[model samples]
Target: MELQLALDLVNISEAKEVVAEVAEFIDIVEIGTPVVINEGLHAVKAIKEAFPHLRVLADLKIMDAGGYEVMKASEAGADIITVLGVSDDSTIKGAVAEALKQGKQVMVDMINVKDIEGRAREIDAFGVDYICVHSGYDHQAEGKNSFEELAAIKRVVKNAKTAVAGGIKLETLPEVIQANPDLVIVGGGITGQSDKKAAAAQMQQWVKQA
Candidate 1:
């Protein structure tokens, strides 16, 4: 399993500061949807330029023109780009094909999809790198999570690795680890902490031990 640090609320400089503290503990640095919205793909370019070793994931949550978006993010030095699971199969295929040509990856975010398992099976057929079960900030506000959805995707997604994200914290990392997701994503769980380094260190340790 790998641990990904999501930089949603931070700007490029703040994102760098946080990564500098916990870079050793994380395998991937995520330029979250919010960060991308705020700083554009320049955020991805900046982070990747700063930490060349750490993989950078651009959370585009793309719904259309997948090929073009993936190409743009890849050009920005994004190792992986995201597409919405609710998007059409043609979009998913375009993204995957573009990613393959660019030697990058596509992670399909199943944030609002209703039938996760079914959709995961279909997406897996397209050879996506990862199928992520995610609960956006709005759903998290209503007290929703994607733990069960993670399990559902794990059951039928044979071609793609599985990932889980949404409000994951040090206190809840153990449960997520037990689910055995291929990748574990956390945003406020670590970024919102008083001691970001310590929080990231502990979560990294736990993910490694698992």
Candidate 2:
């Protein structure tokens, strides 16, 4: 289980707290789209600058002018920049190209993508690091861990690495890993708790046992 700690509220202090707590445990620290859209690229820079050791994933969720967004996030020290899966093929192509030139990583986020299989196949040729299966905040409030969609996403992408997020918890984590996601994300499950570090540590143990 490659843990991704999500920073959604966009507070640098909150982000720093989570990082300080999970720095030794989590693999990737994500600057969520909500946070980025609210706070701009500094959210990514602040998190990256604060925790330089951990890998930073900027959830820019770019939908247009892909190259500019990717380049901007990359310059902000984001190791990985994400673009919306619903974006036009040309936009995705442009983002991927910029990422390559910037020596950065690209992740295509499948948030509300109409045709998961068709979209996945469309961008399979792009040099992407992860095919992120995401659930926005509104959908998460409704109920979570749509294992069915996750399974379908995994089935479609045979080559690109997989990632899944959306209100995940300890018990549901096993079912998520069963889908063979390269990364399993948990935001409130950890950060929402009183002890973020202990929350991370507990998850660390769970993944090791898993």
Candidate 3:
């Protein structure tokens, strides 16, 4: 398993400072959708340039023009880009094809997909690098989580690696690790803590042990 820190609510400079504290412990640094929307792919470029050792994921949550978007993000130094699971198969295929050409990766985000297991299986066949089970902020606000969804995907997904995200804190991480996701994404869990470095170190240790 790998630890991916999601820099959602931060600007470019803040993102850099946060990653600096936990970069050594993290395998990937996600320039989240909000950050990308606010700061543009320049956020991806700046973060990747600053932390050359860590894999940088641009959360485009791409819904259209998959090939062109992936190409643009890859050019901006994104190692991985996200496309919505609910997008058309052709769009997903386009994203994966472009990612392959660029030698990068595409993670299909199953955020609001109603048929996660069915769609995950379908997307898995499309050769996406990772199939992520995610809960957006709104759903999380309604007390929903991706744990059950993660398990559902784990049971059905064959080809693609699996990932889980949203509201994953230290107290809840062990449960997530037990599910054995390929990647575990945490946002406010670390960023909201008073000691970001210590929080990240502890989370990384748990993930390593699992």
Candidate 4:
């Protein structure tokens, strides 16, 4: 499993400073929704330029103009781009194909998705590289994630690679990985801490054990 440290709702300089230390430990560095919305794609460029060795993902939560959004993110140097799983087949296909053409990977976010099994099948069939099992900030605070659901999603989409986001602390990493997600995205767990390198190292060790 790989660890992805999430920098969400944080200022760019602060996020970058944190990333400078943690980048060596984590497999991927994620620019989360609020961070992207607030800092724009500039954050993606800054992080890419700052940490050339680390992988960067831009969480655009793209819902429209799939091709354009992917292109914009790619121009900003995002190694991976994300689009909504709830989008129509054309949108999903468009985004995936564009990312492929640009040599960038696409991750489909399954947030607020109803009929998740059916949606998983659709996204997997559409050739999404990953299907993220997400609990948005509010849902996580409400205690929404269950290991049963995590395991079930992995089972439901046998073809698509899986990832989990929201409220992923070091304590929860092992249990979450029992479902076998390829990656773990954590926001507050690492970025919110005073010692980011230590936080990232802890999560990295936890993922290795998982």
Give the TM-score of each candidate.
Answer: 0.99, 0.93, 0.99, 0.95
Model 2, span 1-210: residue lDDT tens: 588888887477767877886789898999987888778888889988888888899988889999999999988999998898898888888998999899988899888887887888777777677888787788888775456667877787877788888888766777776677778788888888788788888777776565
Q: TM-score of predicted model 2?
A: 0.93
Tens digit of per-residue lDDT, candidate 1, span 1-210: 899999999999999999999999899999999999999999999999999999999999999999999999999999999999999999999999999999999999998999888899999999999999998999999999898998899899998999999999888889999999999999999899999899999998988988
Best-to-worst order by lDDT is: 3, 1, 4, 2
Stretches of candidate 2 above 4 Å error?
A: 208-210
Candidate 3, residues 45-149: lDDT per residue as tens digits? 999999999999999999999999999999999999999999999999999999999999999999999999899989999999999999999999999999999
* TM-score of model number 3: 0.99
Clash pairs, model 1 backbone: none
Q: Predicted candidate 4: what Cα RMSD to the true structure? A: 1.3
What local distance difference test score does each model get?
0.95, 0.83, 0.96, 0.84
Residue 129 lDDT in candidate 4: 83
Better of 1 and 4 by lDDT: 1
